[model samples]
Each structure stands twice: as C-alpha cells, then as structure tokens.
Target chain A: MADFLSAYSIQNWLESCPQGYLEDTSYGHAVGEGEPGLLMDNEVLRNDAIRTTVQLVLGERCALAASSGLINAAPDEASKRFLATQTLDEARHVEVFTQRLYDLGVAKDDLESVLSTHANPHLVAFADVLLEKVDKKDFVAGVVGQNIVLEGMAFSVFEMMHAVNSEMNPKFCHVLSGTIADERRHVGFGENRIGSLIKEYPERKAEVEQMQKEMSYHMLATFAAAFQDVEAINELEKIGEERSHAKFQGADLGVMDPDEMEHLLADTVLGEFKTRLGRIGLEYQTPVAP
Target chain B: MIDDVHELRTDEFLAEVHSFEFWFQSIEGYLSDSTWGHDADAEEEAIDDEDRDRLISVLCNYCVGEAAALEAASGMIQIAPDRHSQIFLATQVADEGRHLEVFLHRLAELGVTDADAEIAKRASPSLLVFKDRLLELVSGKDWESALFAQNVVLESLEFVVFRRHAAEADTITSQVLEGVIKDERRHMGFGENELGRRLSRSPKLQQRLRDFRPELDALVLATLKETAHHLELDAEEERVLGKGYLESVERLGLLG
Candidate 1:
C-alpha cells in the first residue's frame, strides 16, 4: 500500500515530470527543432498539417475539461490527486498542440477560428458525449470516457503520428513523444484507481458500457472523416515520396494506404480499450463501424 | 508566509504571475524533493498519540478544504478569460492536489486506517459551510467570484491556519506545510493581482463581491472558532490571523 501511494505520489510526479522528461523542454519539444520548411512552405502540405494538428488540439481541449471536472467528483484523495496531475498534463497537451498550430503557420489571433473551422463534427460529438458524464459528476463514467476511452484513443493515435513523423518532422514527433508519455500515465491511473470503484459499484458497468459504445461510434466516424481526406493524403504522399522513409506502427507509410493506416490505428486503440477495460472488470462494447 | 504584500499592478508582476513556467518552477523548487514519508519516522517517535490524533483531525479538515480548492481550480480553467489564466489555473489544480495528498499522507502516518471515513467524520460543520460556499461559487460559473473566493478568501484562511500550526506542528507536518505555505502565498498573489485589477475597473463586480463577503467571513470566523482548541492558537496568533485576513481582503480592494 505504501508503495502504491508513493508510486502515484505528487513527489514522484514532480521528480518524473518537470525534473525528468520535461526538463529544458519548450512546448513539449526541443527548442531548436522547427517545422520542416518543405511542409511549411507548401500550401497543400501546410493546410493538411494544420488540419491534422487542429484535431489534436481539439481532442486535448476535451481531455483538459474532462480531467479537471473529474477532480472534485473523485471518491478518494489518491484519485483526486491523480486527476489533478492528469488535468495539468491535459492542459499541457492543449498548449503544445496549440503551439503546433503556430508552428504550422496559423496566427495567434486566428487560432480559435481555425480550431472551430477545422474541427470535425464527429469529433465534436465524441467530446460532447464524454463531457456530459463529466458534467454530471459521474466519476465512474467520466473516468471510463476520459481515461480509458479518450486517452486510450489518444495514446495509439499519438504513437502512430510519432512513428510516421519520426523520420520527417522532428518537431512534431518530439511533441507527440511527450504527450504519448503523459497519456500512458493517465490511462494507467484510470485502470489502477477506478478498478476498485467499479467493483464497489458493479451496476455502473452497464451505463459505462453504453456511454463507451456511443463514444466509440463517434470516434469511428471521426477516424473515417479524417482518413477519407484524399487531398491531404495525396499531398502527404507527395511529401513522403520526397523523404527517405516513414513507418507507422511497423507498417511502411510509403506504401500503406490511408484506409489501412486508419484501420491500424483504430484496431490498436480498440485493442487497448479491451485489454484495459477487462483489467478493470468491464466488457468492451463494440460500436458499429462508421 | 508573505511578510509584506507586494505591489499587484505592475506589468512585470502580472506577467510573471500569469506565466505557467513561473508556477511550474515554483512547484519544482518547493516540492520536487519531498515525498509522503520523507521525515515521518523521525517525528513519529517524538509525538504522543493524542497529539498525533489532534494533528490528524486538523489535517482531515485540510484535506476537505484542499479537495474543494482542487474542484474550484479545475472548473475555473475552462472559464478563465484567457490562455494565460487558463494555464495558470492548470498549475493551481496541481498545487491543490499536492496539498491534499500530503495531508492525506500525514493522516496515514498517524495510523489512520480509513482516511475517507476519518475525513467524513472529522470535518466540522464550519468547514462544510466554507466548502459549500466555495462550491456554490464554482458551480455558478461566475469566474471572478469563484477565483476570488478560492484564491483570496479560502487561500488567505489557509495561509493563516498553516502559519499558526507550523509553529506547533511536528517536524514532518511542519515540513509539509512549509511547502503548502509557499503555494498559498503564490495563490494569494495571483488573487491580489488579478482581482485587484478587476475590482478597480468594475463597480458592479465590486459590489457583488462585497455582498458575498459576509458569508465567507462568517464561515471563517466559525471555522477558526471551532478549530482553535485543537490547533492550540493563542490570543496573539488569533490577533495575527485577524490582521492577516483583513490585509488579504484590503489587498483585493474590498476595504474602504
């Protein structure tokens, strides 16, 4: 019990976070690594990059709101403390992604406009479904939605982006690396802290599963819309052809189609959700394919 | 324990207060090296069980208050007027979380078996009044009122209480509170800088704040009255608390 407490302690967080992985970091990436000129200068690639990053920003914004709103509703000090750290991590995620917009050439004044303009409606619905649980102060449902589902999704998505950008975009890849680390911690907290609570309130399982199904449907739609962007994919391919190598989750992005990449990401995320949910004694509810 | 209040209206001051980096650095400086049982065993043998129980009771109430602060800080992030304020509130949430955790850790060290039940049992009616009022402000979504209630009203009360207790606290508790005191000071600075500016500009908002004060003041007095025996504060410390609370209110431009 002491070990569990110390592992999740704020002292551990401080030592592991700012003093550890985040030292000397500016906006979750190295200071000197700027966006690649080829992508920044090309109009098609720049818009595509901005479009992709806007989703990240919007997703992180939801994460920020959910994590913050769940703190007071947490049943124990440990959960409250973990959610508090998660709130800051989500906030940092928002800031870093919003910074990426500027790095991709969106003006500060135009940020909100671009975010709203580029935000996929399906993604917005996804956030709304999850935030409703948070707003109602349902810690069980909210954690499932935010930590298990949303963060689970973000973890895989970030990993995929990190892989593809590792060879081409050092700055974006660095940013994703930090967020991936943060998301891993958030998901772990969800599993460790909420498992007992779920056992205590076994009836909450059905309601949580229903919420997960609804959220999963919207998440799938979001992926569908994102992957079906032929123009962006073609432009990305053009840029990729010029580069040497790129891989996403071990699949060669140089030859893998957008649909295949989307499937890979979706499968990875859903697979994580199943394993993590089962660990906490909940069944995974599969949503209708978008 | 801020001995003298600093000027709140300078661009340099607001810039630093509003910056996330400033708060993050402050957190690392104060808390990075400390943990749950950092100095517990050394002090555990010195303090008697009755004293430990008294400390645990006081800390349980603190846990409740810190939880309220965590909730309020978390909600305020969304309604904060700008990116800087939002970012600052983010760090504030983390600070409140750390405060709550350290207190809980102390309770556990005191041989508390069930902290949740102990907290529920030990939290005074006065503390609940204070928490309910703060949560009311947060739920109402009046950003300025909530921020003022939290950063000014609640934080000022905590500042005084922690300062008073630090003198008599066992070594482990004192070390933990020394870190929390620094955080509360930073919170008070933010309230003074932010609310002082807003109150100076808007008479209506000022009046709303004025109307809200009596309830918070009543709660504070009731709380100090209730905890005074357990805390072992003397008349001089009470005088200091009264002076400090008034100074905090005055700094927020609430005084004539």
Candidate 2:
C-alpha cells in the first residue's frame, strides 16, 4: 500500500527482461564467447547424438519436483492447508515449465541435460546435517527441506528471472510471468512461517544458517560445474540473452570486462544468498568476491 | 468445489478491532512518556530499572506466549481438516486467551494497570500492521483459513518483528522470546511440512502458494516497514533487518 515494492525495483526489473533474445546466433554462440547472445539456431539443434540422450531423461521424470501428496502426514491443520495450496501451485508450475520445455528446441530431457550439467551434490549434507533421519514428531523432513529452504531462495531468483527476462520473447514472457506468480506465493508461505520461528527462537538462528549454507553450497556446485562446459556455458549465455539479464544489454554488461560475465553471475548469485541470510539475523560466511 | 475465503473483505472486521488496538496504544503511550500516574504506591520500590525491564519483557513475552499458542494452533489447523481443524483453532484461541491473561497479570505486577484501556485504543505503527494481519485472517472466515492468515502470515512475521525489539530488550523481552520460540517453531514446521505434503498429492493444492505469493510478500513487506518504524531503525538497521529476515527465510529453506 505504501510504495511497497519500491518503484525503482519493480520498474527496473521489468524493464531489463530479455524475453526475445535467445535466438541470437552471433559470435558462434560458443559458451565462452563474450557476446551477450546465444547461437540457438538450426546448427545447434541439428545434432541428433546429444538430442536422443536428452529425450530419455525428460520422459522419465516430467513430474514437478516437490512434495505434493504429503497432506496426510501433515503435523497439523494449518500446515495441511498450506501444503494443499503449495501442491496445487507446483502442479501448475510443472505444467507451465513442461510446456516451455516443449516450445524450446531442446526437448524435455535435453533441457534436463542442459540443466543437469549444473547439478550440485551438497544438497544431501544440508538436509542431513540439520534434520534427523526420522522427524516423527510432526512431518517428513525432506518436504520441509525442499519446499522451504530450496524453493524459498529460488522464488526470489525466479521472480528476478521473470522480471529480467520476460521482455525478450512473448512466449518466454508468458511462461516466466505465469510461473513466477506461483513461485512467489510458494516462497512466501515458506518464508512467513519460518520467519516467525526464527524470531521466536533466536538461538536456532545458528543451526538454520549452517544448514542453509550447506544446501546452497551444494546447489552452487550445480551452477559452478556447468559453467565450464561449452554447451552448458553456451546455454547459460543463451539463457542470459533469452532471459535478457540487464547487464547483457547493448555493447556491454556495464562490467569493465566482457570476460567478467561469469564472475558477475556467480558472485551476484552468492551475494544475494548471503544478504538473504542476513535479513533474518542468521550469519553465514559469504564466498569471497571474485 | 471450494469457495475462496480470501474473498472476504476487512471493512467490517477492522472496524471492530482497530478501536481495541487504538485503546491499547493510548495506554502504552502513557508508559512511554513519563506520566506514571497509575497506582505507584502499590509496587513503587520494584518499579525501578530492573522492575521496568522485567515488566517490559513480561508484556512482550505475553505477546510471545500468545504467539506461540496461535502458531501451534495454526500449524495444527493447516495440517488437519473439518472437526480437528476446528478444534485446533478453538484451542488456539484459548491459548491466546491465556497469554492475554498472563500478559495482563505481568503488567499489573509491574504496577502498570492503566495502560490496558489505552493498550489497544490507539494504533502504533506496530499495532497497525498486526491489526491488519488479524483482521485479514478473521475476514477470511473459518479459523483454518484464518490460521494460515494469522500464524503463517501474522504470527510468523511477529516472531521476527518482535525479536528485533527483544534483542535489545530487558529480561522480559528475552524471556518472552524464549518461551514463544518453542511453540513458534512447531507452528511453522507444521505449515511448511503440511504444505509440502499436500503439494505432493494434488496439483490444485500446490498452487496456493503461487496465487498468494504477491499478497503475502506485500503484506510481509508492509509489516516489515511498520516494525522498522516502531524500532526506530535507520536505513542500515533496516537493511540489517532485511538481511536477517531474508537470511532467516533462506535458512529455513522457506525461500527459493
């Protein structure tokens, strides 16, 4: 009601989106090239070898990644309602993203292959370190881990994506915007309740932060490893263009060197992570700025 | 088949509650100022620094106490349905009642009786946000919906909102947080866990988050703004608060 979203923030986010730019083929669309566009034309999609492998992965797991059928195990009523809403939200998300993957030439599994390249292994430690194997006291712990911790941070970034990339292409704009609305609420549910818990329990702050770091660090590996591959790197660059990261605009990303795009994405992501952590009085070691 | 309860508007509800909140604030104003006209002779000696500190803690702790019960009830309601949800919500109301009693007793023990009439009378920045949250919940009808409205929304925000003040507060504040935190944890756990589970079941249920995210974020940010004002925090302090809030959400895996 009172300039809530901050005019500059909302406007700038919407203004910088890269919705229609993924089709650019300049600079060979190679992964490491400094060009801000991706080479997503017939040349890139023509390769059948990698395309087959991609198809297999997508077919096996097309379901939205979330905890949907867990209501009976809910520890309480309010929680049950919240989960009900969240499951509905994810189902919609899966539907929307599945559609988006179809529109893209990469196919679902191909998309997964592209995405899988960024997979990180540290998710286990984060989940295991803080939560016990059996949380019989209330509900299963993994849902809590996935929905709240992972999705929470993810909501903001996705909103960031929708805000930054929606303008690039009409189709992407639709998917990004529609998908984002769902994530925003999903993330909100996780944040609002959890916020109260931490405020209520100051001491728990330490453990929560520790667990978050482990999870985020593992997630980082997903991004970090993929950035090295030519195809993955190219896809990321294309995503940057497709998503139209504001920094990729015109001749430069406003960074001193074009080579710094990798650092820019990497550092910016991590920095936001730490700042998010600090908002709740939880402390965590931020990766040293590159 | 479900009719959206969020469709309920707050004009009627807020009209009723805002007056109470205003009354509370007017009384709080007296304490904040140096008027101290209430029955001083009863507990004059103890009302010194330590007494004042303890009293503040107790009052806030009372808030913390109420918050705890409300949270538990919320978690219960979110996870259950029909009769059980109703039962949990009712019990939660009772828990809130007890907390009110304890808070009032603590205030009286501190020789602070007059504040009650003014306590909810005039809205402070903090009260306004809290009041908004409360009215929103009730307006939604059925405490199950309200539980989500209150515990998941208001109470959860209050935990962080109150904590900032408690962090620098006297014994009562810390004590309040200590007591409240235990209950609050389970409350949030229930909401998050239940939501996750339901999402696992049907597509319709999982989407509640996406639909509600904007409203929730706006509400949260508004609440944060109100708390920031009440705490008299500057930009840096606000950023610190934001950092803490985001970090807290992040840690809980609440944010994605």
Candidate 3:
C-alpha cells in the first residue's frame, strides 16, 4: 500500500487552490484604447494572439480527453484520485482558452475549423502518443509523457508569458498565473509516482529513459514547426520588441530578432524538462539531431 | 427550488461514516468468518443446497452490477465539469471498486472461484440489453443523460433491491447489503445534485429529461424481469418487485 500520498491530501490541496474563472469582459482592457497593442494598428499582434489561443484551446481539449484514459488506466486509488483532479484542471483549461478565443472574435465554428486544420501536426502527434501509452495501460509512461514533459513545457511557457505580458495582457496573465500553479502541482505528482516506480523496479528506469528521449524528439519537432511559420514568428518578434521597450526606456525595438525569441522559448522549455527529469533520478538523454 | 424528491436520505442509511480503510477492514472481517455471525461450525449447516444456489445467483448479479458501476464511475471522473464533482466521482470509483471486491469475496466463500465466468454465463438477454444501454449512456456526450441513467435509474433501483433483500436476509448478508446501500445512496445524491443544477439552468434540458424517463423505465423493467426469472420468483413476487421499483421512480419525480 502506497501511503506516501493520500487522496484526502490531494483533495485538500485542490480545495485550497484558487478557482480560475475569467469573465466575458476580462480581456476588454487588454484590447481597448490605452492598451499597448490596439487591434486596428497591431493586426499582426492580434492575429498571432488569436492563433495561439486557438491552438491552446485544441491542446487543452486533447489533454482533457487523454485524462479520461489515464483515470481508467490508473493502477491504484491514489493515482486515480490525482488523475481525476487533473481532468478537472484540464477541462477548465479548455473552457478558459475557448472563451478567450471567442473573446478575440473567433466564432465557435471558426475555432473548430482552426483546431482541425491549423493545429500543429507534431503537437497533435505528441498528444496521441501519450494517449496511446494510457490506452496500453503503461501508467508510468503516460505520466512521464503527459505530466512531466507536456505539462512541464506548459508551466515554463505560461510562466514566461505571464512575466512578459503582465501589463499588456493582464487578463491572460492572470489566467496563466492560476494555470501555472495547477501545472506545477500536476508535475509534482508525476515526479512522485515516477520516482516510486523507479525505486520498486530498477529495470523500469531504462524503459522510462527511452520514452523520455522519444518525447524530447517530438517536442523539438513541435518547436521547429512553429518556427517555420514566418508570419507568426515575425509577429512574435514584434511583440518581444514591444515587451523589451516597455521594460526599459530607449531600448531599440528594431534590434529585436525572431530567431533569438525562438531560441529563448526552446531553451526555456527544454531546460525545464531536463531539470524535472533530474529531480526524478533520471538523466536526460539528448535525442539525435534530425 | 429543487424539490426534496431529489434529496438523499443519508441519515436513514445503516452504515456509519467510515474511512476506506475501515470499510475494507469490515469486508476482510466478513471474509475471515470473524464478523457477521459466520462461525466456522455453523457455516456448514446454515444453508441447504437450494438456498446456496439462490445465494450464489444473487451474488453473481451483484458482482456484475458493481463491475458496471465501477466502469461508469471511472469514466465520470474524467468528464465531470467541476472540481467538487470530480472529487466526488473519484471517491465513487474507489467505492465501487471496493463493492465489487466484496461481492467477489462473498462468492468465493460459496466455492465459486470463477465469478466473472459465472456472471457471463448467467446473464440473460434483457441483462445484456441493459448493459449495452448503460455503456451508451455513460459514454455519451451529455453528462446529464448519463447521470439520469446510472444514478437516477440503475442505482435507484439497486438501492431499493438491496434494502428489501437486507431486510429479509441473514445477519451476514444483511450487513454487507447495508454497507453497499449506504454507498449507493451517496452515489445517487451526486447524480441528483449535478442533474438538478443542469436542469435548473435550461428548461429545454428539463423537457429532454422528461422525454428520457420512459426509455430508462423500460430498461429498468427489462432488467427486473430477467432478475425475477433468475431468482424463480412467482407472479406475486414479480409484481411486488415491479411495484416497488415504480414507486421509487415516482418518488424521484424525474419526469416532472
């Protein structure tokens, strides 16, 4: 009987955490006058924001669906309880992001079209692989892939976004702050469960390490594909410049470069993923360059 | 206001509020013949062949029902929209899992080693149809419809059946049924709370629920007839069971 973590403790933690609910008018201040990026003049910035929100909405929905499978495959009472709470968190993420997209002027049908057509294939494939692990009842693999890798990346990205855009997009920043706290707690569960598995069966360490390598390769592919979209990259670069200017007066917005911003995102996500793996007593094996 | 018809009379339930450990310990005690009056010497003389067979059949049906409830509860935890509901359903997954184990253990005491195979072999056509409909409801897109079928219909009927059987059975079996009935009542409470909240927000949904009642009642009746046949109930007994089920449904007032 695993007594290290109890379901009652998780229930208490969940109850104490802030519920993240965004109102319909929460984003009005970000898009209206006096905001740094007005829609009329910042079409590139506005389109990029909408596109990112749409992608997040789709990704969170995929996560929500996968949590269902994980709950079914959970090996014990504690894991089931933890995964159940995760399902709620993932569903809320989907709901909030969907509403955010709608607030950005995307209709429900248009949002669905974008999810089906414009979602990055590599990201979709990543979700599919994690879900497949859950279907196969490889509970450890599912936790490592979905919670440690995917959610670890989300935590890092959301933290960085919230820091940079707190003033420009207060509503989005507030939402990310709450979500980041939830993701941190989720990753803690993965670390605890994976650590226990390794201690019980030393041979399973090799299998988990191999799975992590495969996930890292997919993560790199997702990032590489994102960088290939010149328009989105250019818009990100402009937003980065604005953020830099806002932080320090007399900073030249012209000096902002897209490749630098891309490298920053990739490095932060990968670095955090490796750090998380180290905490669980697993070494991060570098994937072969593709 | 939501009517009292949707309320669960938790106070009337037999089992005290206990932790999962306590619940499992009680079940273990039952298996070991240390509790519920299953003395080693009396066990051999307590039941005749005919009575043993009837008990085994009833236990098999209970096992099948608990297995179905376990699956539905697992699925519900994933799709529940709010944290409180998800937490409740998660505990239910544990509760149903424990109940299934209890039934399997009780069957083992009767020299039935292969409980799953026995359940499959004894499952009637109507039971199979009910299982299929249950699977569809639990996996459907509308959460309220799932709640209506599982919590309001199947569980409601099971609660009444357990209550009736507990009243008539020996000390041991009655004790087990009492604990199970308590769990069933809590599960039904969750469904009522969720379904009531959803219906109150949308009058259209209330009408859809009203339209859904007959289909659910038909499924319940079909399962009841099959159960009566398995237990070899005469016309009066079948009529009594059917009437009890309908009265329970009327008390729920799900159609209105």
Could you give candidate 3's per-residue lDDT for residues A26-124 as a string of tens digits?
Answer: 222222323244532577766677766766776676666566567657776456656656765675576567667766666755766766776877778
DockQ score for model 3: 0.09
| Cα lDDT tens digits for candidate 2, A1-290 | 11221221211211221111111211112123221123234344223213322322222122122233233344443444444444433443443343344444545335545645522333333334323411222233334344455565455445444444444434444444544554555454544444555666677665555555566665455444433434533544564633244532232332233245445554555665565455545565543222
Predicted candidate 1 versus true structure: per-residue lDDT over A1-290, tens digit per residue: 34564577676787788778888777887868899887878898789899999999899889988898888788766777878888888878888888789888898779899989999999999999998999999999999999999999998888888877787789888889888888888888889877888999999999999999999999989999999987856775676654334666677866777788789888888888899999999999999988
Q: Report lDDT per candidate.
A: 0.83, 0.42, 0.64
Provide DockQ values for all models, in the order shown. Answer: 0.57, 0.02, 0.09
Runs of candidate 1 exceeding 4 Å displacement: A1-6, A236-244, B1-19, B37-45, B48-50
Maximum-TM-score candidate: 1
- By DockQ, the candidates rank as 1, 3, 2
Model 2 gets an lDDT of 0.42
**Interface RMSD (one decimal) of model 3:** 12.1
Off by over 4 Å in 3: A1-3, A7-10, A18-41, A228-241, A244-256, B1-152, B155-256
Count: clashes, candidate 1: 0
Reference-based TM-score, model 2: 0.37
lDDT for predicted candidate 3 compared with the true structure: 0.64
What's the TM for model 1?
Answer: 0.91
